[model samples]
Target chain A: MSTVNLIYFSWVRERIGKGEETLELPADVVTIGDLLAHLKTLGAEYESALEHQNVIRAAINQEHVDHGDPIAGAREIALFPPMTGG
Target chain B: MTAPITVRVQRDDFDLAAEVAALTCGRADIGAIVSFSGLCRDEAGALNALELEHYPGMADAEISRICHEAVERFGLQAATAIHRFGRIEPGKNIVLVVTASPHRQAAFDGANFIMDFLKTAAPFWKKEHRADGSAGEWVSAKDADDAARDRWTLES
Candidate 1:
């Protein structure tokens, strides 16, 4: 199992009840979509946080990426809602 | 156009006049400068403040990238973007973008372009704090903001 550091922001952070965590990803979790799916299975908080998968934005290594992006070598992954910054 | 880009993400406020001056100091080639500042609003007296959350490493990096792109696209001499993260009260500053160029239009366009992209690209979010002590909600991202960013791709 590969380890991944996951970070959360905004409502996602609140719902998940933490700012960040380290997880052991099953081999089947190859992409961000897979990660989200696996996270939902972890608990109700994650499920509630990622209820709307479409609106959930992810960044690998601090760069914006899509759900289809691979997680092979990602040191960190951030999940959050659409940015409202200006 | 390859000048240094200044990007700051802090909890403290910034001085717009000082920022502008810092960019233009001893710059004989720059002819025009445009500055834009975004302030928090009370939303008809309902807001006590706005709690801003940001991705620590990514916020400044993303804005620097956006500023670099704006500098390249608009031929800007310099660009600086500052975004504050923390609880901000009504009439307090939230963001500042200043762009300098050889001409007025480039400076204006550069500043405009930075703000349009910054709103959608920066890794920051706002949560409202109501004055009446009610629980606040995260501010939803606006469709208009996405449209604003997309329009720039069409322009250039």
Candidate 2:
């Protein structure tokens, strides 16, 4: 088993009621898809924000990654909106 | 060899010209400058007032990454960005992006690119302040903003 740090920003945080958390995952969860599935089980707040994949953006260790990317070696996973920065 | 970027999160107004001078100082190759200022529109007609909030450390770090990518994508010499968090009144500036380059085209493209990416990629949440004095609901992210950002990936 490995522990991963997750961060939710903006409305995701508002909806999820948290900014960051650490999770312990089974070794079978080796990819972002696996992680998303695990997160979807956390309850209504997590389900609502993540139910629609289009609105959320993901970054592993501070660099953006696609949904199909592997998360096996990731230390930090952050999710937020598409982005609105200047 | 020094840091070529500046990023800030504040509630105060900024002087555009002064900031630009600081960015372009001692760099003779910088022949052009372009900047964009995002303001709170009282009558955007779509939403009332907007309350913007951001995660302190995370917001700054992500914004710096976006600015760095903008500099490379547009061949810019330098870039500066500032975003104001908290309750902002109508007609107030909310964000600013300034880019400098040897050519007008790079400067212009860099500024536009940064704004487009910011609107779609930044992590700020807006709570709409309605006209009735009672707060309106949160404004969902617009598809148009996402489309605007997509155009860039295809072009470059």
Candidate 3:
């Protein structure tokens, strides 16, 4: 098990009630999808924040990645909705 | 010479003329410049302002990546992108993209390419501030924007 920093943005952060947190990952949490699943078990806030798994976008070290991507040695991971900037 | 790409994410508003002048003031090779400014609209008077939220480091990095790609793909001489965060009122500028190229078409295409990609890839979000003193809502991401961005990938 290892610790990693996780960040939430926009409504994800609003519902999670915090912008970031440090969590100790279980050995089974090998991918981003697994992490999201694990987070949902922690509390209702996490459950609400990640209610829709498909639309939740993830970024490993600030670059976008698929949910199935491995989170082996990432220092930070940010999750948010689809971007709306121009 | 390689194209110069400038990507800035800040809270301050930028001047259109100054940015263009900085990139093309003394250049003889560049003959065309295209600048696009994205502004905040009042939503037919339902909104007072827009609050832009962004991931600090990633916002700048993602936009820079998009600008660089646009410059290379269109053979632009220079590309500059500036995105503002925090509360922006109606009619104020929120984002700017300027591209310079020897030919008019490249400059236009380069600016358009940067905007299309930035809208979907950049780590920024907008929230509406109501004028009637009610709660504001986070603006939903539009599927139309995703469709717009996808056209570029299909072309290349």
Candidate 4:
């Protein structure tokens, strides 16, 4: 079991009711996709924030990564909705 | 022989003319400079301001990466992008992109490329603040923005 820091932004943060947290990932949580699925089982807030995992994007260590990307040795991970800047 | 590239994410507003002058001043090699400034629009007089949020470390890195790509792809001498976070009043500048090149077309296209990618790739989000003392919802990603960015990929 390894701990990973999770950061949420924008609506994802609002739905989760917190901006950041640290959680111990189960051994099975080896990839970003695995982490997302595992997170959905945590609670109502996790489920609500991650209900549309398809639209939500993830960044590992501040760099954007696909869901299939490995989570090994990652210190920081952020989840948020699509960007709307310009 | 590329000039310096600057990328900044701040809560403070930027001075357009000053920023442009800084890039072109004392540089005879730069013959053309194009700049684009994105302002906060009221949109039907209902919006008072736009509140921008960003992933601090990621915003800088992503914008810098895109600006670098624009400079290389467009053969630009220099490129700069500034994005403002926090509440920006209507008509105030929210983002700025400036590109300097030896020719007019490169300068123009470089600025456009930076703006297109910044719209969809940067880790920034905007929420409208309505004039009626009500907070508006966050703006969703537009398909048009993705299409705009995708066009570049197809072109390459």
Candidate 5:
């Protein structure tokens, strides 16, 4: 299994209090849902910050993706908001 | 010509005239240069300024991409943007965009296009410093900002 880079931005960064981290996930675990579930165990902060699932947006390898997408063989996973850039 | 465009995120204040001169840099073929400066206003009866936070690397890259896209989509000559984060004084520049083109309309439209998209797309968090010496952070997204962004889509 390859290592996955997890990143949180904006409010997510504030809530997580860390910018980026690398983790090795179980082979069976894929998809953003699985990642969120795994992250929930990190602490109370993750649980509260991620309480509402829909508001959070995500991207795989810098391109935005929906929650249902699988993370198998993913290298970088970034969680952010509805992208407010111009 | 090799550089896609210039996009910068900084904490210190910027000099508008100097930056513009650098970009134009003896390019007399550039007929029009459009610029937009967003200021920290005292609109809400507040004494202090606003503090902004962003996703660092992502913010600049996204904004740069937007500028490049706008240039290609709208036929612009060149575009540049500078967004300042952290504590900004009232009446200081929050964001600035300059677009150059052979025609005035393209330059103007390109600058406006970038602002419209940036307001809604740039992943920046704003927290205002109040007169009471406290701070109030803006909630997730604003409807007006979304409306501005939607106009570009409608045009296409």
Candidate 6:
């Protein structure tokens, strides 16, 4: 098991009610998809924020990665809705 | 000589003329300078201010990376981008991108490139504050912005 720091932003943060958290990743949670699935089981807030998983974007160690990307050795991960910046 | 690249994500407003002058002043080689400033709009008089949020570290890194790419691809003499966060009233400046090159074409293209990429790639979000003292919903990502960014991919 590895401890990973998860950060949320924007509406995702609003839904989850927190900006960041630290959690222990089970061995089965080896990819971003798996992590998101595990997060969905945590509580209603996580499930609500991650309901539309396909629309959410993830960054592992500050670099954007696909959901299938492996999370091995990742220290930090962030998830948020698609960017609306200009 | 390679031009300097400046990327800043701050809460404070920036001075456009001063930024451009700092990049081009004393450099006779710069033949043209182009700039783009994004302003906060009232959204048809429905909003009092626009609140912007961003992922601090990633915002700076991503914007800097794209600015460098724009500078290299366009053969720019210099490029600078400044994005503001926090509550910005309607009519205030939201972002500034300035590009300088020996020719007008590169300067123009570089500035355009920076703006296009910044629209989609940067980790920033905007929420409207309605004029009636109600908090508006978070602004959703626009397909138009994604389309604008897509054009650059084909050209590159």
Which prediction has the highest DockQ against the true structure?
A: 1
Residue B66 miss distance in model 1 (angstroms)? 0.3
Write down the TM-score of every candidate.
0.98, 0.83, 0.99, 0.98, 0.84, 0.98
Better of 2 and 5 by DockQ: 2
Query: Model 4, stretches more than 4 Å misplaced?
Result: none
Candidate 6 deviant stretches above 4 angstroms: none
| Model 5: how far residue B52 lies from native, Å | 2.0
Better model by TM-score: candidate 3 vs candidate 4: 3
**Candidate 2: tens digits of C-alpha lDDT, residues A65-86:** 8888998788899887655433
lDDT per residue for candidate 1 within A1-86, as digits (tens), equals 99989999999999999999999999999999999999999999999999999999999999999999899999999999999987
Give, for candidate 4 chain B, the lowest lDDT window spanning 10 residues: B1-10
Off by over 4 Å in 2: A84-86, B1-3, B26-28, B44-48, B133-135
lDDT of 5 by residue, B1-156 (tens): 532378899998888898789888967778888899988887667757676877767678778878988899778878889999888768888899989888899988898889988876666777667787765655457678888879888989
Instruction: Tell me how each candidate scores on DockQ against the true complex.
Output: 0.95, 0.46, 0.89, 0.91, 0.43, 0.87
Report how far residue A61 has shifted in candidate 3, in Å. 0.7
Q: Please tell me the TM-score of chain A for candidate 6.
A: 0.98
Interface RMSD of each: 0.4, 2.7, 0.7, 0.6, 2.9, 0.7
**Pairs that collide, model 1:** none
Of the candidates shown, which would achieve the greatest TM-score relative to the real structure? 3
**Could you give the CAPRI-style class of model 4?**
high
List, residue by residue over B1-156, the lDDT tens digit for candidate 4. 757999999999899999999888788898898999999998989998898999999999999999999988988999989999999999899999999998899999899999999998899999988899876899989999999889989998
Model 1 misplaced regions, further than 4 Å: none
Report the C-alpha lDDT of model 6 over B39-127, residue by residue, as the tens digit. 99887898998889999899999999999999889899999999999999988999999999989999998999899889888999998
Could you tell me how far off, in angstroms, the CA of residue B138 lies in candidate 3 after the best superposition? 0.7
lDDT of 4: 0.93
Model 2: which residue pairs collide? A82-B120, A82-B121, A83-B120, A83-B121, A83-B122, A84-B118, A84-B121, A84-B122, A85-B118
lDDT of 6 by residue, A1-86 (tens): 99999999999999999999999989999899999999999999999999999998999888889999999989999999999877
